[model samples]
Every structure is written in structure tokens, then in C-alpha cells.
Target: MSDFQCHPKPKRLTWAEAACFMVTGPTAYRQLFGWPGNVVKPGEVVLIWGGAGGLGSMAIQLTRIAGAIPIAVASTDERAKFCLELGAEGVVDRTKFDHWGRLPDTTDEAGMNHFHKGARAFGKAIWEILGTRQLPKVVLEHSGQDTLPTSMYVCDNGGMVVICGGSTGYNGDVDLRHLWMRSKRLQGSHASNFREYREVIKLIDAGLLQPCLSACGTIEDVGLYHQLLHENLHPSGNMAVHINATESGSTELA
Candidate 1:
């Protein structure tokens, strides 16, 4: 196998740093700003799920750059603190809800009630976090089945939910009422196109975007990195594996 694969690296980013943001950075940018016809505008409120994770971390920073306010749903206290540092104006801990993003059987009335109950509590928490402010105008969603319902329900009328991945599961239950009655929109975004990706690269080179890499090591650490991610034990930031010794760079987040 080749020791390293070459690509056009951003001039301002060290090899390790570039590797850190390669996947998550462009994906976040596409979801929050670069998606055609789905731009997040100034003064809008955005809700970002997993706001401390690789994708959400970048999304939080991009939201700030776009002059929008970002609210984060974090899985842990440490992650919540990190989200705040990365520019999330408010953080809600997902652990508080027993089924924050889960849905039950539609065929069973009791199950449907249970799902709504959890969704209601989840929506209440978001509103309380924002106080009397208007509901979120955009939701940066990826945790599909677990959170899409809440994302649709909590967003303001004519708001949007831009989804990229489904870490939880693919199938999601969205209330058509929320879509048609409230005039809400659900937009699906995939990987960034060449032009969109480069836009974010420019932002990175200009120092407007920051890396959230929290761990890195040589090729020997590959197994460990996979273990961490596979087991969902990786920190809320990105991790990198250095293929070429010369590419070694500091992995600590600033």
C-alpha cells in the first residue's frame, strides 16, 4: 500500500490538520451554508445536533460566521462545554430525555403517544433554552430516526431541517402536519460539490475556520482510532492518523 495519497492540501493547513477536517468540514459547510437554495442567513436561529462532534463542531463555527445563532444538543457535559467554546449559544443535554429522538410503533396508539410525549419534552427543553426568542429557523440534523421528529416539530413555521447522515438509523417518522401546516421544509444534503468544498477551504485558509482535532498519532494508532470510533468512544472532535512521518503535526485543539 502507498504510504500516503496526495491531494491539493489547503495552503494554510498543516497535513494533519487538513486530514482532520477533510470529511467533516466540507460536509458541515454543505449542510449549513453551501447547499444551494438552503443558505443560513444572519439573525436566524439554528439547532445543531451533536454540536460537539466533528461535523457539528464545524457547523457551529460556520453558523457564527454566517451571523446566525447556534444551539447545540450535546451528549455529555464535556461535549456541551466544548460546543459553547466553539460558538454554540446554548446547549441541551440529550441524556435528560429518556427517548429524546426515538419513535415507537405507529400501529400501536400507546406507542405513538409515547413518541409524542418524548418529542414534546424535547421541544420544551429547546424553547426553554432559547427563552422567549423565536424558534429555530434551521436545524442541522444527522441523527435521523432518533431526532428528525423533534427537529421537524421544534423548528419555526417555514423553517428547515437540513440532513446529511443518519448516525442513528435511516428510517424516520416526520409529521406531515408539521411539514404542510407549518410550511416547514426537510432538505437532504449529500457530500459537498467541488465548488462548495473549495469555498470552505478558503474560509479555512483565511483563518475564519478552526480545526477541532482532539487526537492524532502515527499509523500504529490506526487500530486504536478505529476502536474508539467503532465503540463510539472518540471525543467530540476529529482524530487523524499520520501516514507519512513528515506529515506529523500537533493534534491538540487550541
Candidate 2:
């Protein structure tokens, strides 16, 4: 294997901008463009789970670039607005709604009812925003158990849900009837392939895809930022960590 597999950063992009694209860029590209069967056709509507975060930010831009309509869901109004600014056609502010339910030990009747109630309410809000005239053709999901049930419920018949990671929870409970009866598909994708990475790089170089960088710090601060992310206290968008292998110095973890 070659030491330098990726291309040199484009002259137009700053180090922060290039760094922001590292993982999120290719994943977003694969979700929208590199799906195996290409379920999301041009001009289709895509429901983005977190339009202001790393993956969702890139997904919104890619969705727009692909000539699709992006409907973004964010936890706050400011984040929703940011997603709109990034090209999402519609926004769902989750803070305004109460979608709550914990996984129960046994799918007991009461527990199952509670879970279904929350999922139904969430799906209703999505449907209200989308209206009967328009339903999402594809759902860009990664929140996993937190949103999968609703994602499957609200998706149009024959629509697809393409998931990458389970940021909230991985053990998702999907309604089999909605999936099998409606012929909807649930697909999983890992990281992007080499070709997908290059395709995203070309877009970055051509100025078609913009990097969503929120913050940048020296490698010394990597631990600090990692803790913030682990604690769910990190800010929205991508964070850049400047790595310099030649420089030798150890910063004590604070």
C-alpha cells in the first residue's frame, strides 16, 4: 500500500476546510451518490436526521447538489436555520416536539405502547411537515434506534432508508409490516470506498462541495475535543485537529 493514497489538498481549500471533509465528506457522498442500487433518484425528497452536524451538514449539501430536496431535522432552531442556509428545503425543529421513550426490558404491552406512541407522534410531525402531497423518497438516517422506527414509518412506499452509523443507539426496533408490506428497504453502509472518496475530492476541488468546519485546534487539544464529543458537549459541524508528526511534545491530558 502507498503512503500517500489521497490527493493533495486543493489550492482553494484551507487546511481546516480539507480536514473537515476527512470522514464526513466521503460518507455523505456514499449515502447520496454511491448507494448500491441508487435508490435515491434526482429530484427526490430526502429526510436528513441532523442537518447541522458533520454527516448531516455534508448530506444536505450533497442532497442539494444531486438535485434532490433535503428536509432537515435538528434539535434546535439555530441549527435548523443553519441547515436551511446550507440548502435544505425544509427543517424540522425537534426541540419543539416531545418524542420520548426508552427501550423496555420486555416488549410488555405497556412498554410497547409507550414506544409506539412516541414513534407515532414523531412520524406524524414529519408527515405534517411533508404533507400528503409530498413524501420523502429516501431517508438519510444515522441516529439509529432514536429515529429508525419513525424513519421507516414515515418513508413513502418503496422508499429506502440508508443508514451509516448508530450515534444514539444501534439496536433499532423497526415495524416489519411497514417495511415488508410497503416494500420499503433498509440498507446499511460502512465507510466510503476509494472511488467514492476520489469523487468527493473532485467535488471539493471543483468548489461544488463546501466543508463544514466549526472549529480547529492543534493536535495537543485532540484529547480535549474527544472528551467533549464523548460527553455530548461538542459544538455542531466538523472539528479539525492539526496533526504534525515531526513536532515532538506531549501535552498532559487536562
Candidate 3:
């Protein structure tokens, strides 16, 4: 392991909490701030794709701390509630929309119209939450193939959609017109560097960020967990498994 990989846990955090945030926090940070030509500015609207998921959850907190408004796209009402609880300015229930997936060719009138209609409605949903016509300045993307086009459609002009992983599929459709005409960017990102990791931990240490640990399991459950994740049937929020780490005598007697 490299020296940059090791981070000290803040005393106020449980092992589960620290572990839950260790990866997602920095990734989210990098998505918002570390990416080229896509740094999130104060008061910007950041639309997070997986609002209740691990990355989305952390992005919401980091966005707020950066003086930006965070809106989350969630699948369920329960998840929407969770996002709002985490200080999301708004949460859009993604289940209502059916126009996700690869885009049709530009000349395909019907397909393009239907897709545009649905995308506009999606943007309207965000406007409804914001009480304004302004769209997200930065869209945090992970569901690649299905939602990428819509993300491009709704993002504000000159804004960016920073993508980390493609959970839905790899082949996301992008209209080059959106790039040259609107001056928008679709940026790809991955894990953050050590500086980004340490910055997020500083937020945790300052009590500004909450580690949203949804579940904890043992080493034996890792396989089952990954299977559930692949099927998208796992519980929301981040999960942690203790590997060679014992919980015994770790908590103070209260």
C-alpha cells in the first residue's frame, strides 16, 4: 500500500462510519471539485444522480459545505426522504420518468421528440424544486447509458456533467451538438488524489459531514453484498465489512 492510501480516522467516527465514507467521500469530492473544467462554484445547483446512494449522499453534504445547492435524483419516495434529510435542496423521484437509455438518431423525429419531452419534464421537476427555471450547473453522473443523455439535456449551458462510473451500462449517448452549441462538457472522473481524501476527512473531523452508514457486515457477507449490488437489490447507503479489524473494546463505556 502507498502512504497516500492510509488516512487516520477521526475519534468521533465509528469504524463503520469511517469505512463507509473513506471511498465515496473522496470520489464525490473529486467529481465536484477535482475534475478539469468542472469545479463547483458557490451557489451552484449540483444535481446528483444517485442522491440516496453512497456517492450521492456524500456529494449532497460536500455541495452544501461548498456553498452550493444540492438536488438528488432518487428512485423511491423513501430514498427521496433520505436525501432531504441529508440536506438536499430537493429530490426528484426517477421512477416517474421512462425516457432513460441510449438516444435515438437525430433524424428520428418521434423518438427524439419523446425523449426531449421526457427530458424537459425531468428538468421541470428540478425547476419545481428550485422554484426557478435554472437547471443544474453541474450534474453528478454515475448511471451512464440510461441517464446520460437526459443529464446532458437538462444541464445548464456551459455547465458540466462529471461522470465517475457507468452503473447502468458503458455506452452512453452524447449529442455533439450539446457540446459545441451549448459549450457544455461531459467530463470523466475516477478516484480522487490524496489531497482530496484528506480534505473530505477534514470536513468529517470538523463535524460538518455525516457518514451515512446504511449497513455493516462481516467478511463472509462480502460476496453476498457484491451480488446484491450487481442486482441493484442491496440496501441504500454505504456498507462496510470488517476485515482483520475487531470491534471489541473499540467503543467507550457510556
Candidate 4:
């Protein structure tokens, strides 16, 4: 049978790494290069939400490869370290702030003030990491309700916020005043196409990218793994199960 999905494995990728690369790698590549109209350019800043997970890991390296500055948002020290190891210019500890969810209406002065204070602090954190007052040209977003408002707020004028999933709640708010006044773009993308996938594979083959898989387990641990993931206790990067083989790649990294 002819299979379009089959591609020659990269020289540096193991079977487990290949599995990790196939999805997140291509999706990330397209997000930075093809999907968004405001694609990432060299030397531009790119803010990536969930920067320690499967997609975020790929986004970090891909952004680095593209010559863009990548700042990752992570919740823990370990996760933040993982992003840094993957070449993120900086890592934001999301747990430090609490201003999340929908932006409060203008009528609620107290709520708005609290939100603004937290949001500005978070934005300032980005500036601190960057060592300058510039904003991100592109925001890689999979987080939805909790971070979208801030992403829109800190994105550079006429920048793009490209999203693929909502691991968090789906109700996200975009502050239209800044969005319209600054001419920002919010673009939605799905899984990558063949060309995108092929490019990722080639990059892996040439050693310009890594799979960044964090762990592997037997099929019996699927329930436990999913539980860990849902509870946000899973390791950084991709996690895979040994379907028919005894082992595949590095078993743990978090």
C-alpha cells in the first residue's frame, strides 16, 4: 500500500524520537513558518505558552532555529529548565501570577485594577527576560482562557497570535481595544500538511532539531500516564508507550 505519511527516518532520531517529532514538530514548524500570516522572522521575539510540553518543546527549538528569540511560559522550575535547555531565551513561571481567566468588564473597577496589575507585572517579566521593552512579534498559544488575554496584551503592534489547541478552558478573551488599535491578528491552525511534515523530518535528519521526548512506558501505564497528565504532574516534553517493543528511547527527563 502506498502511504503518504511514511517518510525516511532522520539519522539522529530513534523510533521514540520519531514518534514525538511526527506531530508536535510539524505542527510547531507550521505555526512558526506557514500557518500564521505574521510568520516569525529572524531576531523577532516569540512567546510560547506551555513551553515545556510536546508542542512547546518543539516551538522553542524551532524558534531558535528560525533565529527568533523564544520565551517560554512554564509553571515549575524543572519545566522552566527544560525550556531553557531547549534554547528558549527565557522562561516565565506562570505559577507566580494569578490574574487569569476572562478579562473583567470595565464596570468592575477593583477586578480590572487587580487584573491590570498582575498582567503588567507578567508583561514586565517578559521585558526583564528580554532585557528590553520590546514585545513579541508572534505568540505561540495552546493555552486558552488563562493566558490569551495576556498574550494579546503583550504582543507587539500588528503582531500575530497563532493557536492550535486549548489545553486549558476554551473561553478566551481578546482585548479588542489593543487588538484593533494595534492591528493584531489571531490565527487558528490545525495539524500540519505534508510539506510541513516533510520539512520537519528533514530538519531532524540534518540534526537541526530534536524530538525532546520526556518519557516512555508500557501500554499498561496508559491510565496512570493520562492521570498524571490531567493532574499536570507529567514530565516535560512528549510521553509515549511501548506498544509492541520492550523499550524505545530515553525513559524519563522530568
Error of 4 at 70 (Å): 0.4
Off by over 4 Å in 4: 246-254
- Per-residue lDDT tens digits for candidate 4, residues 140-206, read 9988888899888888999989988887889888878888999998888888988888998888888
- The list of candidate 2 runs beyond 4 A from truth reads 1-4, 100-117, 127-132, 245-254
Q: Higher lDDT: candidate 1 or 4?
A: 4
Cα lDDT tens digits, model 2, 1-254, are: 56347566756777667767879988977877766555567778898998888899998988888888889998877788888899988788766654443345444778767766776666666667657456678888888987787788778888889899887787887778788999988989777888888788888889898887787788889999999877756677888876763332222211
Weakest lDDT window of 10 consecutive positions for candidate 1: 1-10
User: How does each model score on lDDT?
Assistant: 0.82, 0.78, 0.89, 0.87
Q: TM-scores for all candidates?
A: 0.88, 0.86, 0.95, 0.94
Candidate 1: stretches off by over 4 Å: 1-8, 105-107, 250-254
For candidate 4, report its TM-score: 0.94
Better of 3 and 4 by TM-score: 3
Residue 179 in candidate 3, Cα distance off native in Å: 1.6
| Superposition TM-score, candidate 1 onto the true structure | 0.88
State, as a TM-score between 0 and 1, how close model 2 is to the true structure.
0.86
- Name the best candidate (by TM-score): 3
State the lDDT of candidate 3 residue by residue for 1-254, as single tens digits: 77866887877877777788888999999999986666898889999998888899999999999899999999888888989999899999899999999999999999999999999999999999999888899999999999999999999999999999999999999988887799999999898888999999999989999888887888998999899888777676788887776662253322
Every candidate's CA RMSD: 3.9, 4.9, 2.1, 3.2
Weakest 10 consecutive residues, lDDT, candidate 2? 245-254
